[model samples]
Target: MLNSWGEDIDINTTINTLNGVSKSSSSTSINTSTSTNSASTAKNGDTRSSKSSTKSLANSAKLVTKPVSSTSSFFGKFTGGGGGSSNSSNNSHNSSTGTNQASGSGSGSLTTTTTNSSEDTREGNDNLTIQKINASIGSIKGEDIKWDFWKLLRFSNPDKELLKFIRARKWDPNRSSIALTRTTKWKAYDHNVNQIIMDGEYYVFKNEMTGVMQNLTLRKAVILGHDLNDRPVIVVRPKLHSTAQQTHEELEKYVLLVVEELQLFFKEKTTTATLLFDLTGFSLSNMDYTAVKFIITVFEAHYPECLATMIIHNAPWLFTPIWKVVKAWLDPVVAAKVNFSYSLKDLNKFIPTEQLPKYLGGELDYDLDRYTPPDGTYDIHLNDKEKRTILLDQWRVLIAEFIKITKEWILSENQSENKKLWLQKYDLSQKLRAKYIEMDPYLRTRSSYDIDGLLVLE
Candidate 1:
């Protein structure tokens, strides 16, 4: 099935396990591989709880790219075939007009129309802008920019993606061209960023901070319902943050993941979203300027025209100094959207209380663990490089364990007896198979009748 973004999503497996009890049926097939060592049954009469796992561009002349399916026909309206004019110029030459002979004979009268220079000039500028953007994309591809893996994967629609860089610089061809080229080089050179995504640095963070700070609950920087005009409302709880607990990089990754995830939640590709910063628990410890700077840079550089309005709720006196610095870094368009709310009444002007979270005097209560990408959105499948990284990580662990076991066996003088005992105790083959499944079940599948302890890779 196609996602809201028009990207194909293949949901190969759906296993439901509630309270450690596996449920297998036609509706919900159970394909769980647990470390039998951690299994324990809940009381029959006790209540059981289940928690599900959950996981833009542009400026004026708003950065817009319809879904691939729609864009094929949509862009045609802009560059379709048809606008030609026939030009006929009537020339009169006097050769022997001494006798002033009034001999005028015309076969047909030809008339030509003059086109609007201002209108044509605007069109020319737009075409030139698009060309420059394309050239920048060529450079990025030629130089092999680091996140260009999306292109290597052959995910369709290069023009649509290139539109993002074009709008980032406000449709300025020269500026956007330089911006795209520099961005590609910057990303390619940043080995640390490669480690951040490829190394799975996000997994190292505590689930609590990652879940909350990432706005998984729709309570913290949650994407609530839309405003009156239908722009999505994103509530951000700055109080929930502590730089000591979460590093700047981890926070940046969470922001990137959350923003991208929210993009999928939009029913249509929206150019704007309402932002609410709930700074009720404003503390000096939460003042991580580095993280703030990084977040702003990503929004301005990569996600233009995404912010429709921003409401800062309950800003303490101490935050004034910090806002002073942050305001300077923000774009004019973005800075203009900022609205500080002293109370819920002020915030209600932009977003109704009904759309706000309960803590902020809203009617909704969000559960983070039960969160899925809102509206059936799934995680973007890992590109080939990403898949390789994950596989390598799993293989590295397996090889380490194998080497450790081999070394122990070699250290023992009685190899035969030791081998028999080690095989019987560890059940290496079955353990490895189970480990693989635990690491990622999508890579392997098993039958309902398959026994856990007996299962082994060939």
Candidate 2:
């Protein structure tokens, strides 16, 4: 049932698409509204079932199997430097073509033998469940239960961390293994991250004429609240374009910063998040194909299962055409996780009236200036710019603290433990990055617009 775009989205697609709703509507029964047109159904929550079966096969893991020479394979060059230390376990190659080989002689392999789709899915779910249970009991590292700061930082919570990789790789151990390796490799660049977070002007968009990146009203995104699972729910308005001139690289860094902050804030509850794209007033002018592509690529490729769900709200007919183009970049599993809402009523089914924005048929009055007050008290007398600055300062402090912890931990550990941690970081980051780049072979050839689609306002 796979289509040129992905797969035949199934009934569960609708059910799972509203995972956020499952959290709030304890008493309400969810009834999906069907439309005559397929696109209408797609737009109204009748999304395609997760193309998980096809992806469960290792052959579909482009990130793991692809040659390491590609420029987009940034983590591939890192070589998981510390995983092969004297005290650590040995990595070994799996016979499977789709997965990356382990670093040492450890009996662990991602998934070497191919299983039927049913068996594969079952195994993947079982493993994820086991990881979740282990995480609850604090048994992440094979029976060793002491709370090591290195392991805690390496895995915010082992079960949730593994869940991100599992979701990204469709529960295939081999694919998840490769993904984990890439993430471990990414940790070595903490010093670079320290620099990036401090350079507020470089990270956040700045006006071309004034050179200030601190305007609160121009900010297009914010963390609204948490979902039922207590994962942070982030809201983005693609229509709200930044007046400041920003490059794709800078935009990516800023977004990554936001993801890091969210992870830190919700580390105790859930490592992932939910994204809501408000496309009600979106026009072709709002389209920034390159920036949008970069954002999606970052989440799907670099972040992995950190995404719980993405709901596109109130998209006009015009957005549908653009979505088809944009959807081409999404992995089947990721694509399946997206739900399109054509009306506030459609959104109301899954999201309670209280949790939604007032404009979208909810009671919450979200203020751009004081939506989130750092001190829990909002001084209404303060102007918008001042309030915004306070918010930014709060964010800076949070980011600084995160960087400080990560760097200090890495430095305090021995070489062997350090290698193991870096290996873990690299595996996740690489697998995510590789997956997206693999899908877009012409990623380099395309200009920014070609990457973003019509959503970006020129």
Candidate 3:
């Protein structure tokens, strides 16, 4: 079956798309009027669906596979990752921890307050999940897991890596372990994400039939500035994207490349990002369902809790029906993060006027051509491969030692010993981060951020 973009899609996917409304509405009904009225003061509001609307919505929805299904074929022949069934297990931890509450002041500022809460059971669950993740680390290693990138994340901040999966699965250790393992396998064996980073701006392919060379990074998405919370803002111009420009595989690679690049900007304090979807001049032809599904899968399964907010700006009436079905496919938590901005003032609430793009009623004049790294800039890294390999080997050894200490920390009963082991792990993680910085030149291609000295290596 052909999707809205006229791309051949699986028959089962088409069927699922047709049935999305029935399936999604049963669980969470999207009040179109309520949503529109809350986000925009436009008088022309309509909440009506006809048979033709259903067909169009279904056609658009075909770009999105079943959200909870594990065997979606958008990302090559991978049988896992995206959404997978969780395996449940019993937990015995009963400890309580302090809770931090942030209250907003009258003048648009936040005040933090910390208090001990006996009702807080998250700490105990977190400890149990960490122990479970540590135990499964050995079995999940090999060619399937991108050892270099995984080690980079583990050594940089092991707790943060573990907590992402744990929190995504709601502190269910078994499910978290399963999701983490599957994602690693998908990234390494299925997607070859490490190779994508290595390829960088050189990721291109020529269509033999068309005799046209297609660059994967097509300037459709650009990292402009930071949000109010200092999260890196990825502004996506869907109007610039078309399925005819590249093959699905190329599009997938481009999307993953952008995601990996974005991850580099992440800090300990800023773990998430804000996606600003500028839908100006967007139409049916601009929709790429496969790309959309792949993005959803990556966020929900692979990179959980990585998106702080997604602002949809200047959405036209044509997109309303598509969004109705699309929002239903999203996880409730993810859906909740979606916000609508009808005007420049609405956007300024999340991003400052100084950082906002000029087109979006802000002062920042961001040109994609200027923001993109010039040709041959990333070529310098090719010579550093040998140095990168040596550093990687060293990191492997350090990670091995860290893992041993991690196991000891998980099992240690003495509070003092636990604290000491934790400090040791932290020190090792910092060393790992340093090692990554040393190997960074060889591993990743330089972006515009590096050229302009905007990216500070910590």
Candidate 4:
């Protein structure tokens, strides 16, 4: 039978392989090692032989090598294609474009398009849309409530964030605002996300269930490196999972912890991430539907436009049905970010060999066991209520100033004056971010990245 990606497979052979029943005499059967230890491990659900077969299939897989023109196609398809004109155009625009101006309605309808000799017209439209969003927030009766909404969202780069919502909602400001507000409330009240960050739930769980948390942490997922576009790469090994291991609540908290850690890696340009799922040695024992559904919900609803690509590597035939079911749950936009990879070469198309892990045919020799956890000593001084309160009060002042300038920037008709206010707003936003960093050690627990010196505060 042929799988969705057009890969040929013998269902009977796959079943026999999973059952630890050898069929080496059959021409279609995968070549097997005669080692007793390998057979014993497969019988115990380790599936070493199946992993070998997956690697063999990956080596022989033939994939399309043509270039794709559409931005969605470049990131979405599993074909061994190059990113074409669309990617180059975006790169050029990012590098060369300066001040953006909105050409559409003052309400930020995103209906008009324009061109300029010196700037990308889309930047102007996006900037105008963001201004409209700011204007909407400015209209709220209570200044404290308006600033509190911004604080609840909890990340620097308001323009970049607002743009994400706008693009996710197809450039409709009204829809984006609704989506943004929903996320804000969900994170603040429903999830109590700030408390989760403050409690450092992962560490709390680790202390309680040392053996399970240690094993899961070392094997399940890690933010290893970056992809070609400098987006953070999260490496997830599903084969390490088992439904019997962790409770639904514990699993949810662990996933949230990883995501919270991921936030520290985001820059102005690199807001999205590449998720690489290594499916080698995967079997029925590894399936966790509840965990999968929760993860899907977290990304699709709360973290919109945050996935650059999701690479499913070396998936066995057994995963096909599960993938079909999973695909149904994904939003069409989220589904477009999914890609299948059959080999190391396939992965290299998105992540360079230098940044890729050595086990995945890359130069980086990453060892999760060697990773150091942060000690609970970095922010002890901030435990003083008075000190922390003063810093937070200062932040509120900065937020007030930022919102004030942003409103002026939006209202100004003079090009030069608008440009000046834009710069002022930009500077205030940066200061707001810097202040957040100064208070981060107090607000949240230190992550592994902090211990490893990978967290860039500036």
> Using TM-score as the measure, which candidate wins?
3
Q: Candidate 2 residues 1-458, lDDT tens each? A: 22111223232332233222212122111111100011111112321221122123322322223221111111111111111211111212211111243233134322334357864564454344333322232212210111111122322433245456666676564455455544433422321332332222222333331322332235566666655565667778877665344555556555665564454345434567888898877888878888778677667766777787888988888987899998998888789989988776776655666777777777767654342212212223223444433443332233223322222222322544444433443343333323322322211122112222311111
Question: Which stretches of model 4 miss by more than 4 angstroms?
Answer: 1-148, 152-155, 201-216, 370-375, 384-386
lDDT of 4 by residue, 23-54 (tens): 11211111111110111111124334333332
Rank ordering of all candidates by TM-score, starting from the highest:
3, 4, 2, 1
Weakest 10 consecutive residues of candidate 4 by summed lDDT:
92-101
> Which portions of model 3 show Cα errors greater than 4 Å?
1-156, 205-218, 369-374
Q: After best superposition, candidate 4 residue 57: deviation in angstroms?
A: 51
Q: Per-residue lDDT for 347 in model 3?
A: 94
| TM-score, cand. 4 vs. native | 0.65
Q: How close to the true structure is residue 276 of candidate 2, measured as C-alpha lDDT? A: 85
lDDT for model 2, please.
Answer: 0.41
Q: Considering every candidate listed, which one attains the maximal lDDT?
A: 4
Taking the tens digit of each residue's C-alpha lDDT, what string does model 1 give over 350-442?
Answer: 877777666667676644234332221112333344563455345334433432342233223354544442442244433444444343322
Q: What is the C-alpha lDDT of each candidate?
A: 0.41, 0.41, 0.55, 0.55
Residue 237 error, candidate 4, Å: 0.7
Select the stronger candidate by TM-score from 3 and 4.
3
Worst 10 residues of 1 by lDDT: 46-55
Candidate 3, residues 312-420, lDDT tens digits: the string is 9999999999998889889999999999999989999899999987777899876554534335554585576466557756765565555445434433446566557
| Cα distance off (Å), candidate 3, residue 94 | 31
